[model samples]
Target: MILRLALGLFAALALALFVQPQAARAAYPCPGGPGPGEVQVGVSGGSHGVAAVPICDRAQGGGGGGGSEVYYRYGSIAWHPDADDVWMEGSYDGPNTAERTALAACNQAMGGGCTSIGEWHNSSMRIFRDRSGALWSGWHGDGGVHSKKTLADCSAKQLLPCEVLGTYSSSKNRHLPKPTARKLYAVGAWVEGTEGFDSRLYIASGQRDAATAERLALDACTKATRQRCAILAFVGNGVIQTYRLGTGDQSATVESNAKRAAQAAQANCKKRGQACTLQRVYDSRTPGEFVHDFMAPAAK
Candidate 1:
């Protein structure tokens, strides 16, 4: 009898050893059919490193294998070898509302798998790739990058007027898109000085040629100052040309333009009158490419 019992125990141990390791399970996803405000069970926040709970071992101890339950308002999932590093991600259905009906439903169907849920705010701005291979810029909130927000509705297909906003005293340090970008821009002058020409001197879209840039510059200056304006570009070897407009005398304008143009033509040139402050400036070595009073200096 003793020998038979020993053999049976040994066989049981072998069977236990031979059993396959239980595969790590994934979080239950929300059903696809839903409207804009669809709630779902997803990877919760604060789950960068948590062990996966084995389905076979759910009843013994509290689930999650001593790992803390993590919640996310939106779903963003990832997997890795280390149990502590495994994470699940998803959109939090509740942003304005506090309840998590969707998350509860998901857990109910999955035999009590649970992730704490919390709504997330605008996380970050990123470039999203759509199926068409085009890149769209939008804000990342708790509901993922394409979720809704109080200020802006990014859920729509296109992100229109992707301008930066809210850098002034009236607003916080947020960067909203235009028509918001336009609102945040200082009313006095978008560009440095030449305030009167501010409205006319808008930054043109796309890269501009020498002639085109010069023409636009003149347009802005004349619109702001109402004086005859000339814009010139450096062509190296001391050759430069100017684009001009308005009734102001060409002589003085060209003289000023030439003087300003020459400053740029010289090595390590900055402002029209500002000195080449550094001795070993990189432009001193490279030929061609000179700095003109083109784009306004960044605001302090």
Candidate 2:
């Protein structure tokens, strides 16, 4: 009996070896359960097959063989854990569909309350929601079109970075917000004692002295004039000149004596006036800028 059984097993094994074997499994199907673009048609089998299932591309290990992650592909984009689903959907393949999906996600996430969607942006979607829970779509684009004042959405609310970068300023203006600083020459001139004249005008980096202002003041007025004074204060775009009108057509004499008279006047002012009182010269130009005192109480 034992010999017969052994012979029978050998015959079966020989028969199996003669038949053609099945091909090995290839790459796992497009994640979610071997669908269209899948390598092997039906579900995987045995040790060579996929074991543990995935949760929306996330794997849950099981059995002796570790389970493989199942990724969901929307067009060319693939999403995984820790990735922004809304952004992925919005940025994938086509703009119309992806952007629409992204908008829906954002609107749903934010409570659907404010203004409607304004415009679609590269990485951002603008949905306007008011306190009343109304939702308006396509209001702001990615760079943020609408200027939102407060933070809140109606039905479904989504919180975004609080960076105002839209066409409105404080939700009141329609034009784009003004820039904080503009690249401009800001060309401005003031005679001696004028605008920035606390005697702290800097000629260049690391070079500053009160005498610079005094010198400028002395040469501000026209030559050959009775004026023999320095500019005490000049602001905006204007000039100042002082007069020491001597007796008669000192016009000719004044021009000739300008250098000497100016020197004398400056020296006299420094000696007679504490802090060197520089005289004020009259000006005719209108002011364009003004001095703003922002010093603290102690300094004031």
Candidate 3:
């Protein structure tokens, strides 16, 4: 009986060792045997779980394993005197390639006086001509460049009456067919009640042109308030500001059109024996209103 019992104990120990390893190994196996386009299973550490990896055939380019490919191309355009003779080239491997292609095409068609207007890579750009007839271009990377920023850039370069001519986008695969230009204007007003109140100010902007915008602002202030309104500033597509400095009926000046506006205002204020400071700066292309009291601080 003792011998039989010992033999039984040995058989149970062997079973435990053999069966445990087999069960663990079976938990994670290659879902499909080693082959192209097969699922590979791996055991995670410490009871975390099993993970499945995909096997790909690089030779056949069958599977990418969630990877993607990207290609970059450039676009360029050349402009001549005649609109119909404009030449454009796109989908080139390099910027110079697009530029050369456009120039070559343009020169081939219309002698040798061809100028490259713009170039872009995997993106878009817009061209504009200011009232001064200067060409400016704005580039957009993903969505597009902001119209305000583009206009501001042109204005900063002292290009007046700036307007967008057209847009070219690689993604769109074409240029804007029509001239989609918009005009921007800014205006400011100052008013004072003849009865008792001090000066009241208003600014209006984003009109089709400078004269209309100024007229609209002055009209609005005159009709809405009981005070007499006077035009302080009128400008087109640029920054404008007013300054009121020192105490007791401060002198005010409008800053716009020229950099000399500020210097003149400051000089005038200083002539009155008071320290003049900037009160407000305004953009005509941006529609808004501002109001402040110069007398309040003096009264205090």
Candidate 4:
């Protein structure tokens, strides 16, 4: 009887050991199996494949054959006087690192003074332009709040003529492309503050041609002050200078050559006995080209 009892116990123990679930033998087993942001995918032969999954939380992590790892993502937008751009980054190792990375990328591509337009983790962003020519951007994890916030913010800023451009999701797309480069024309106008008049300054940019830009600037100035505004500068393919005389007389002369534009402006101002201080210069070229020609140093 004693021998039979010992044999039965031994048989049961062998069966239990052989049929144990593979999950019980996992290399890095959590007490509650896989936690949030984790999924157990079954591989062939009944082995549990640990994988990281996208979670609503800002920080996300996953498990794989090698081990567990964390991921970070961010999105951003930047704008200047005439253009704007967006950026996204992921696979970072620290908190808020993605925000800095995105900002750096945006500033590098769009030049300095770029703002931190938006940031997110496992989320996306969209931008809009209002009829009044204001720009707005918003971001959200699940794509619900962004639209509402974008419109609300634009309204808060009193931006009219608003329309959504599109949405960009890191989960669905790679990086957003750069804004299109184009030749730009601009106009600058300034009204002198006289005893009965308030001083005014107005600028219009990104016009297709110099004439159109000048017209727009003048119209804007007249609408704002109800007084005639003289064009201070015109830019297209080169820079031009405009000046106002002390006698309340304004003169506009276009020079095809940018090199002589400033000199010509000063000469005109001097001939009219003006201080030559009311002259303004404007550039009519793509921002990139303008930076290269003026901001960058001459080749040795």
Cα lDDT of all candidates, in order?
A: 0.23, 0.22, 0.45, 0.41
List, residue by residue over 1-300, the lDDT tens digit for candidate 1.
000000000000000011232333322222231234333322111221232111111211212345666332332222211111112222343332322443453344333444432322213323222111112222232223121221222112211221221111101122122221110000001222333322222222111132443345456555656665433211111122111112210100011123332332232122223233211111111222222321223210
lDDT tens string, model 3, 1-300?
A: 000000000000000001112321122222242365422211111000111111111222222234565345567666543222235577665436766777787676556666764454555555554322234444433233233344554544331334566666543333322221233566666564345334554567767555677677677677667567766555544555455556534433332333545665566666667776665555655676545444445321
Question: Candidate 4 vs. truth: CA RMSD?
Answer: 27.4
* Better candidate number, 1 or 2, judged by lDDT: 1
How would the candidate models be sorted by lDDT, starting from the highest? 3, 4, 1, 2
Taking the candidates one at a time, how many backbone clashes does each contain? 20, 35, 1, 3
For each of the candidates, the C-alpha root-mean-square deviation to the true structure, in angstroms, is: 26.1, 33.2, 29.1, 27.4
Error of 1 at 81 (Å): 46
Error of 1 at 147 (Å): 14
Write the number of the candidate with greater lDDT, choosing between 1 and 3. Answer: 3
What's the lDDT of the predicted structure labeled candidate 2?
0.22
Residue pair clashes in candidate 4? 52-62, 131-160, 131-161
Candidate 1 vs candidate 2: the TM-score winner is: 1
Top candidate by TM-score: 4
User: Per-residue lDDT for 1-300 in model 4, tens only?
Assistant: 000000000000000011123343222212233456543211010000112121222112222224556343343333433342345554443335555766676667656655544334444556554322234554433234434544554444221223565565544324543555223665655443332233333566667554677677777777767776666555444444444445544443334244465565566667556754335454554231111111112310
Task: Give model 1's clash tally.
Answer: 20
Off by over 4 Å in 1: 1-70, 73-94, 97-123, 127-300
